[model samples]
Target: MTHSRRSLLAAGATGTLALTAGCLGFALGNEPLEFDSDRVAPADETVAETGYEERTVEERTMERTEEIGGVERDFEASIWLSNYSKSVDYMGQTREGSAFAAVSVPGMEVAGQSVNPLDEMSNEELLTEFLGRADSDRGDIENIQQGESFTLEILGESRDVDTFVGESELEGEPIDVEIKLTSFDHEDDLLVLFGVLSKRFAAESANVELLMESAEHPIDT
Candidate 1:
């Protein structure tokens, strides 16, 4: 019941990433639309070609409360999602699919009082948790750099987010990642949300920048 190799890295490593399609040209608002499970019907060719199950679609909506610094932050959002699970499937021994995106209520610290989603784990922690296993083709550890936390207007509110991007080799192949973590305003937790794209999708630096700048929420306008 495994999805794919990248999917496992996506979950165990950096939390779930998100793919975006404008939710079907729907206005980016708090509106629950009908999502047919059949839309994600597995392609017969995909199953036949890869010995994998066809992906199915599911309507997903959720809400959760995260505690940060003894305070509560509430979050909610909905999307059509697919699931993947794998174990020792690669070559009957190697691995893979999914981690859900995270959402944080937007807020910032004031008067030097700390208030952001659970402090984002340090880059070192992230490396251990996510990229520690990468095998650089270069035969040396890839250079990783954590950017400073910054704020931008997301969903009509000012928000703070931490970003990280690193390079490495996995099984002798190159691996590069860019992650953006954030905390909600009214809570003390941090989350991974908004969107994710492969190098093919994010070919331009600007596309990656856009994903880091945008976000999703259950907020009704």
Candidate 2:
């Protein structure tokens, strides 16, 4: 964990003494909380005010097709966009029930214009550049170790994906991390996707492969 995150955890831990950690998770990315006050509200009231509900939902298989860059494309998956963690670090989960977390801290990097200078590189070069940058960019993650590098497809675009192993301290408890990252390349532009999940969930799901294959053929598969 980074020093900044530790500080947030410390503050949140202290703040959670009066309230619950769920409240802190609710405040995750919404607003800067003012904890100087001594007011303590009931747990149910606190939950009601935040309006962040934790839900376990089953996924539905679906497909979407579109034309981009004068080429036809298809996207099939068992999950739709679940922005349940919009105000937090995660994106959503796959139909196989794995969590998708942000690779770069929000606002630290934007998906606009594919700032990826490797857009013109060979597949080998792109994978090499991406793994190195990913190691550096994810500073908020702890003990991250790169696993493998390969090409994959998303939304009919072939791109390089790298597997990673790391650690995360959720609610002050350490959890093993496994993540896959890739970019959807289209017309010299890119769409980056990052998925982070616990070791237990990783062992139980084929979501990583399914997501990469959603568009039909994953690169180098």
Candidate 3:
């Protein structure tokens, strides 16, 4: 894990303690439910039309054990992620830029504790956690500058998102990347959408937004 990721997680852990006290759904006898990775990804037609190829669709889980009453209890959260990429000509060379969406829901396992981690997190915190969990293979994100706030539609509902600019190494070259991140409650799930665009082409940023706007995994798929 990178230092940035560790720091974000540490901050979240402390915030969780204070937020859980007022969470109405905190460990309300709900069983943890696993979401289907296939359904969380954007539709095939959507990707094809957007000229992006699917890279990965998988469930990423985070497990933790907490000591309560001198006994150890285990808890876990399942995060469904769907990644996609597209090749573009940048400075006369073909380069691949990527984007992805990750979704997590309530009802995370709480063992004997009354605090549900997901329920305790706000949308901004959820976005931070999702960004922190980015794969190391994607290169380390650095010098993040938070940008504008805007509204976008996801799962048919309007959501507010914050934009950010960051630098990352892409194939031995430094590339400026734009990130649009948002987290919000939708129906029964906490939906987090993160779109990354390498500023190789002028249209790449718009493409990233299109990819995110088209994100969806049917419940039955």
Candidate 4:
């Protein structure tokens, strides 16, 4: 069953790209949700608010192990969340570029396959494309008429790949999310994880434009 799940995940990566195009034209729903930066404080604040009873950052190391396709994979993840944004660092024992960071909502899970941002493209180009697509589809339920799964193809300077975008509602706010997984040629038993975390920038549909303008590197270190 584990092997099968891994296989399904792999296939899902490819299929996500293909389905994005069709999903881009549908209306999913239009229930607005409130997004208060204060609702979910950052890791540090959460710890403080909890009276420091929880584990400290120095003591906490997020890790998960699983066997996929007859191979054992171990993942260690660290997260830093702030009022403005969130970042995650994922490391795998066998992957070449074992480390990568994503800017998103705090406590977001790393799902799907892994992708290397240092591949043949630049971060600015990649982020630009991501924000552009999200902007084009902002507040438009027509893009999500076919359930919550959809994929879109994004063109880059030297290469192009399909990206899967998923949507959900939280606290009356619309949540737009994406995941990209790619296999590295150098590693036979490793996969890359690429993810996007986003919410409506504001009450109006214009917030998409702000997010595009404000998007930056999730992790500085």
Best by TM-score: 3
- List lDDT for all candidates, in order: 0.34, 0.37, 0.58, 0.27
Model 4 over residues 89-130: C-alpha lDDT tens digits? Answer: 223221111111222221211134432222344333444433
Error of 4 at 5 (Å): 23
What is the alpha-carbon lDDT for the whole of candidate 2?
0.37
* Superposition-based RMSD of candidate 4 using all C-alpha atoms, in angstroms: 19.9
Best by lDDT: 3
Q: lDDT tens string, model 3, 2-23? A: 0110111111333332223323
The worst-scoring run of ten residues by lDDT in candidate 2 lies at: 102-111
Deviating ranges (above 4 Å) for candidate 3 = 1-39, 66-72, 109-114, 118-124, 132-138
lDDT, model 4, position 67? 37
> What does the lDDT come to for candidate 4?
0.27
TM-score attained by model 4? 0.23
Model 2 per-residue lDDT at 188? 22
Candidate 1, 1-221: lDDT as tens digits: 11110111111233322223333221222332221111122223433333333233344434444332333433333333332211223234443211113333222222233233234555346334433222111233345567676776654677776665665443455756454544342222233332221232233334333443443443222
TM-score of 1: 0.33
